[model samples]
Target: MSESFTINRKEQLLEVAARLFKQRGYAATSMRDLAAELGIEAASLYHHIKSKEEILETICFELASKFSNAIAEVNDIYFNAEEKLRMAIKSHVQIITENTNQSAVFLQEWRNLSEPKLNAFMKLRDAYENGIRVILKDGMNEDVFADVDEKFASLTILSTVNWINEWYNPNGKMNAEEIAQKLCDFILGGLRKKLVTDINYKP
Candidate 1:
């Protein structure tokens, strides 16, 4: 096979594998099952992929990188805490929606990863969560956000965005941008809510 065809075939295999990984837990999926889904013999599938775990590693780490880079990009910009948070959320939802299968696998299957890889994946996840928490901290410092529990807020936001994989449909009426905006608005509304005293004050 030509180099280009080989690459495309491998990518197609990964895509199919991601779908299966998302549908069935990684532990329940097998190379034979992946081959059957792709309408290829087990041997042919092996030629394209080394192992099922290898496919899971690729999908999980690729998405971990996307999420890391997305928030990192938002942090590099000059926006205020609120805008920075908004942009970060938008970037996140875009990654999730654009690669729903891979995102689902990434969200749900990382625990199936072995050894040092799982360690590495957890570190990446912590860094990404910290990146978001810093924005929340900055907002509190700037008085743009209420003083909430930083870890609580961070986990809540992460849980909310991550749950999109369970219910989000690209063909659903709401597009990625719409979903991102709504999420941002909802999150920011909570973060930026005023105290009753502040609301009652006539300054």
Candidate 2:
């Protein structure tokens, strides 16, 4: 049988590398920089990991899998389309909020992957977009969402959710639940239009 390694320096390297990657990004971060952060020589890291690309792969794959699993779990729920959309927002926000470093590495460092690996990641990424798009289509069908361009509306909604990573702070005044609720309400409000007939009619 092949040999398997136990938890050791490599795990530590992965952890520290994630932070550096988030701060400096994949293109700018160097192996020497990662080694210095971990208080070890650059060559020592090689004993555990083959190269820096492995670190990027580990972070990206882990985050992608977490996000993929969360989306799948939400799909299993029997809620209506609008409710599903809310749950998707809450799930995405909560995951990123809780694991800020990993989430950051996953979001910004994806471009560092090799072509084959990037293709694989894109497939998973598209799965998420497709899942959200289906929910948007369902909401449109249910008449809960106003008559809007499904594709454009879906893109806008996804962009809004993705931007939260830039400013959302778990240690800040607002908790994840509160932020999710506020965002859900805000997006839903925009997606809906006032009944024109009621504009001029007063009870």
Candidate 3:
């Protein structure tokens, strides 16, 4: 196969593995099953990679990196906390929607990692989560996020956003961009309504 075709095949493998892992969990997804899904012999699958863990790592690591990059990009923007939060929500959701497979693995299989690798991935994952929490805290400090409990609010937001991979079908009613915008509206609206009002005008 041509180089492009080879790359495509490998990507196909990753995508399949992501779904299988999501549905069956990592340990249950045998190498033989993966090979059969890809229309190749079990041994032939080795030609492309080392082992099943390699595929899991590839999927999870790329997603961890993607999440980190998205948060960093949002943080670098010259905007206020509200704008940053909006952008963070939009960017994070968009990345997951675009890379649903990797997103699934990242959300579901991180716990299954072994040894030093699990610790490393969890560090990156914590940074990503904390990046969002920082945005929320900044919003709270600026009085843009109202009187909400920061930790609870942050986890609620992240959990809701993270689980989008479970029920969200891009082929469903709304397009990815539309789904993201709707989520932004729902989250921001609630936050906005809870904003602390001051007596700038006596009404």
The top-ranked prediction according to lDDT is: 1
Question: Looking at model 1, which ten-residue stretch has the lowest summed lDDT?
Answer: 194-203
Candidate 2, which segments miss by more than 4 Å at Cα?
Answer: 1-8, 191-203
Query: Higher TM-score: candidate 1 or 3?
Result: 1
Model 3 bad stretches (over 4 Å): 1-8, 191-203
- Writing each residue's lDDT as its tens digit, candidate 1 over 1-203 gives 64453558788898989998889878998888989998988888878667777888999999999998889889998469988988898999999999999998888889999998999999999999999999999989888888899999999999988888899988899999999999986786556767766522444
After superposition, the stretches of candidate 1 with alpha carbons farther than 4 Å from their true spots are: 1-7, 191-203
The order by descending TM-score is 1, 3, 2
Cα deviation at 156, candidate 2, in Å, is 1.3
Q: Give TM-scores for every candidate, taking all chains together and pairing residue i with residue i.
A: 0.89, 0.86, 0.87
Looking at candidate 1, what is the lDDT of residue 180? 92
List the global CA lDDT of all models: 0.88, 0.83, 0.82
* RMSD (Cα, Å) of model 2: 4.7
In candidate 1, the residue pairs with backbone N, CA or C atoms under 3 Å apart (3 or more residues apart, or in different chains) clash, namely none
